[model samples]
Target: MKAIVTPGPRPVTDPSALLDIDAPEPVLGPRDLLVEIRAVGLNPIDFKVRRIREPGETAPDILGYDAAGVVTAVGPEVILFKAGDEVFHAGQINRPGSNAERQAVDERIVGPKPRTLNFAQAAALPLTSLTAWELLFDRMRADPDEEETLLVVGGAGGVGSALIQIARAKTRLRIVATASRPETREWCLDLGAHAVIDHSGPLDEALTAAGERAPKYIASLTQTPRHFEALVRAVAPQGVIGMIDDLPPGPFDSLKSKSVGLALESMFTRSGQGTPDMIRQHEILAEVAALVDAGRIRTTLTEVLGPMSAATLREGHRRLESGTTIGKLALTGF
Candidate 1:
């Protein structure tokens, strides 16, 4: 098998940040599926991990999360899928990732790929979809019948895009997203956001101008600490806010005054700890696939860099670090 790996955490600008090399076939566990990867998706976590060395780590680490592929074999305990079954998953953080020709993934966290999409498109959904779904329904506990509002910050990114479509299709929350540019604002509206506001300006005033109320729930997709105060002012009393980004130095005591509840949505939590509810990810991805096939939601993939190679992946990393991409980036074929 061929794999891309980093010798250790290094700056993305470093010439040897990532390299392609031959590796052994992955070994499987009782509940594992050995997948022949057809495509892989890139996320901020890829670059973040590259920039910071993990403590006590002595070997090169394979770094990827989202992947879509065909099952080549299954472990003895696997029942949900078999050889030749098409699947997609965000593999566990503790295990070697999917940036390879083959990977061993727990079947409990894998789901059937959307029938309407290609491998690149399917690969783009898993990580972001799980993050958005868990943040909205699991962490915030949104009600489908409630006529509340959801305010999404950094609305043009992958997770933000997924968050908007899911909230629109599955809940009655009036969706409001923040985008700084005209094209990004239009993209959010086209994806089912009821209103699009500019995060570069005052969020509260933008919400008011859009004829929306203080949101009952806020999904801060990025720059959580930078927008903390504004989020506190823009949320209704007793509201809940969820974030999936790194929070900089700041005090959250203001949330206490408003009875605001805060939560962090880390998609890797279930697989990282081998939780009892780990199967929930499978259910979530299965539901997302149905939504895609039904035309309720679509893939966020915007760029497909050629084949899976170290050079192409490095360029993809540069694009992500530039912070100008509108949606997800993927690479197809090994």
Candidate 2:
């Protein structure tokens, strides 16, 4: 199998940050689906893992999570899919990833690919969709029927794109997203955000100027620490804040005064801990696929780099690291 891997955990600008090489076929487990990967989505996790070396890690670590492909073989214990089933999944973080021509993923975490989308489109969804779903429904415990306001920070990126659409499609939340640039702001609105605020500006001032009320929920997707104080001020008392970023050193003790709740949403938690609810990812992806097929939502894939290769993957990482991509980036075929 052809694969792209980092020679070591180095910078994306490093010549050997990603290299193409032939790798042995992934070994399948009892519940695994051996997929012939047709498309792969690039995420920040891929780049982060590439640039950070752990103490006991080896070279050429495969680094991808989102993939859309066809099952070429199924493990002996698999029941949900067959050899010819089309599937999409964000594979486990603990195993070899989806950066190759073939990958072995647990069937319990995979979903049927959206029939309305092609390989690249479907590939762009699983990871971001799972993250947004978990953040909104599980972490924040949002009421789907309640008319609440959701403030989504960093609203032009992949996960933000998914979050806006899902909130609009599945809940009554008045979606207000943060995007500094005009293009990004427009992109968020197009994806179903009711309003766009500039994260680069003062959130309180922006919300007040826009006639937006204090948000009942905040999805702090990026720079959470930088905007933590602002969010604390802008969110309604007793509001919920779910973040996916690493916070800077400090106590979030301010959340105490308002009795505000905090939660962290890491999509990998289930697989990372071998939790019993790991199959919930499959359920979320399936729901997302149904939404896509019914035209209630659309794919967030805005760019497709060429076929999977070291150069293309590196360039994708460069764009993501620049923190300027509007939506998802995918690569189709070998």
Candidate 3:
């Protein structure tokens, strides 16, 4: 299999940061599907893993999560899919990932690809969509009938883009998103945010200036540490804040006074821990696909940086690390 692999932790500038190699095929498990990867999406997790996780000495580390592909074969215990089924998923974080021409992914987490989208577009949805859906509906338990305000931080990024659209499609919340740049602000509004504020300013003040009430729900998609105090001040009393980033300890004390609830959402949790409800991801993706087909939600793909290769993936990582990406980046073909 032709694949892209990381040697170990290295800056993207180093020539050895990512390597193109002909790797051995992945071994399939009982519930696994052997997929022929057609398109792969890039997220911050891709770069973060490449930088931090050391590869095993025996096998290369393949770093990718979002992928759309066709099942070439299925393990004996796999009941959800068979040969020739088109699928999309953010595979388990603990496994070798989708950066290769072929990958082995558990069938329980895979969903049928949206028929209305191309492989590149479908690939962009899985990871971001799952993260946003789980954070808003599963973790926060937001009410669809409530007209309360929901604020989204970093609204131009991949997860934020999906979050805004899904919220608009499924809930009645007054969506307010934070975006500093003109382009990013417009992007959020285009995706259905009722208001856009600049995150460069104090969040509490930004909400005030934008005429938005203290948000009953806040999805802190990035830089949770930097925005911790402001978010604490900005949230409505007894409201909930859902987070996906890694935060340093000790911020819990501040939320106590306001009676604010904190919920941490990690889309990989179920698969990583072998949870009983791991199949929920498959259901979520199926619902998302239906929404996509109904034109209620759309793919957040911003760019397709040529085919899958070490050089292309390196450039993708460089752009994501720049912290200015306005949506998702994808690469199709091998």
Q: Candidate 1, which segments miss by more than 4 Å at Cα?
A: 54-60, 248-250
* Residues 210-296 of candidate 2: C-alpha lDDT, one tens digit per residue: 999999999999998888888889989999999999875678788899999998999999988989998888888889999999999
Structural similarity to truth (TM-score) of each candidate:
0.97, 0.97, 0.98
Write down the lDDT that model 3 would get. 0.94
Model 3 lDDT tens row, 87-135: 9999988888899999999998999999999999999999999999999
Regarding TM-score, does 2 or 3 come out ahead?
A: 3
lDDT of 2: 0.90
RMSD values, in order shown: 1.3, 1.3, 1.1
The C-alpha lDDT values of all candidates are: 0.91, 0.90, 0.94
Give Cα distance to truth, residue 252, candidate 1, Å. Answer: 2.3
Q: Which ten residues in a row have the lowest lDDT in candidate 1?
A: 52-61
lDDT top scorer? 3
The segments of candidate 2 whose C-alpha lies over 4 angstroms from its true place after superposition are: 54-60
Compute the lDDT of residue 211 as modeled in candidate 3.
80
